[model samples]
Target: MHRSLLAGTFLLLFTTAASLAAAGSSTGLDDEIEGESRPAPSSQIPLPQEGDKPEAENGEPPEGNVTRPDTREETPIPDVLYDISALPEPVQRMRKLLMDAARSGDIENLRPLIGTGANRTQMALGGLEGDPIEFLREISGDDEGQEILAILLEVLEAGFVHLDEGTERELYVWPYFFSVPLEELTPAQKVELFKLVTAGDYEEMRTFGAYIFYRTAITPDGEWLFFVAGD
Candidate 1:
């Protein structure tokens, strides 16, 4: 009986201690949850009224007010520009004949012009040479001639000519004769030729310095003289 009473007493003490410990743990957990649930000090702060607020430092809109719109104005872009095409039959034919003659060094196209007169022959023959200034003189003389010549010289002085040699006779004319012959030019000579061909601060080789290429060359064959003009 005594042992049973002691055992019961011990059991009751243990239960009481366990209940107290569980209550303490529950209280601690509740305190932690309450502390976490409380609002942050910064978040609890009140926003100032518009009228009461201080002026912005930079005098700019607030960060919240700035936003990019879904649409914006765009600049209109231009299309690739090409030169006015030379289309009139006479001009076209003349241009074609001139190009062909320049390429082949053949004056067959100037046959009709030869019958016109000495002046016409001189002018037309000048066109046969690769000088754009001379061509302008043939086409339109005087002030216009001077203006075009100036423009031509400017372009020649600065611009590099990229001649495309192809089966196309008209285009091939440019490459066929526009360049100084490789056999006639040393490496340094070739560089000099390129420099004169592509001269200045501007685009084309219209400058006063390009006349050397337009001069004539008498081939060793007395029967066949080559015009140094185009080449």
Candidate 2:
């Protein structure tokens, strides 16, 4: 599989008015990142050419595999999420439960289910690299962790490209604007991509910094191995 170049590391700057009190909470208006406009044309990761691309290019899944219930049927492929229904039912169930644990910041809930294949919690948040639960508590410190968890789940569930299928772990990828060299996209496409990620603080990441999408690695049985940001 091709590795995306926009892999990035973020120095999480969290300043919230309250803790992550509820399992289902929003980052509140004042707490959310302000995404007024796209970042300056500075970061520079080039994209693949048009023709020599994978047969499944962010629009639709390959046929023959469309007999499942959750198949898109006649739907447009979303820019961030993949049609995970294409996966086995057990995987689908596990993925949902895993994301729920993340959304709620219930690390204890996820600990028992973590697969042995992926022990490095080195995917998101720059490098709170340790046990995934510890990584959550370290980054969130409260309910504020919910946003980080939500961001991760959003990316994992919606990544546009299914990079490859593996025996133990499956990989997914997305074109996070921060991961892409901002300068590489046409001004308009940058704006569109930024809008998709809810919001961000790209103005602070200009110069040599590159924002990245989370490359989520999960087991067929629904274990989240790693979910790191990449450029």
Quantify all predictions' global Cα lDDT against the true fold. 0.24, 0.38
- Best by TM-score, which number? 2
Q: What lDDT is reached at residue 79 by model 1?
A: 20
| Model 1 per-residue lDDT tens digits across residues 82-128 | 12142234433443443344344333333442222111222111112
Clash numbers, per candidate: 15, 21
**Model 2, C-alpha of 204: deviation from truth (Å):** 5.8
> Which ten-residue region of model 1 has the weakest summed lDDT?
38-47
Cα TM-score per model = 0.21, 0.46
Candidate 2 residue 170 C-alpha distance from true site, Å: 5.4
Worst window of 10 by summed lDDT in candidate 2: 37-46
Instruction: Give the residue spans of candidate 2 off by over 4 A.
Output: 1-81, 117-131, 141-144, 165-170, 174-200, 203-210, 213-215, 219-221
lDDT string, candidate 2, 79-193, tens digits: 3444777866775776677678877765567666554322322232221223445444334324334544655555545434443245222334333342235566566665655
- Model 1: lDDT to the true structure: 0.24
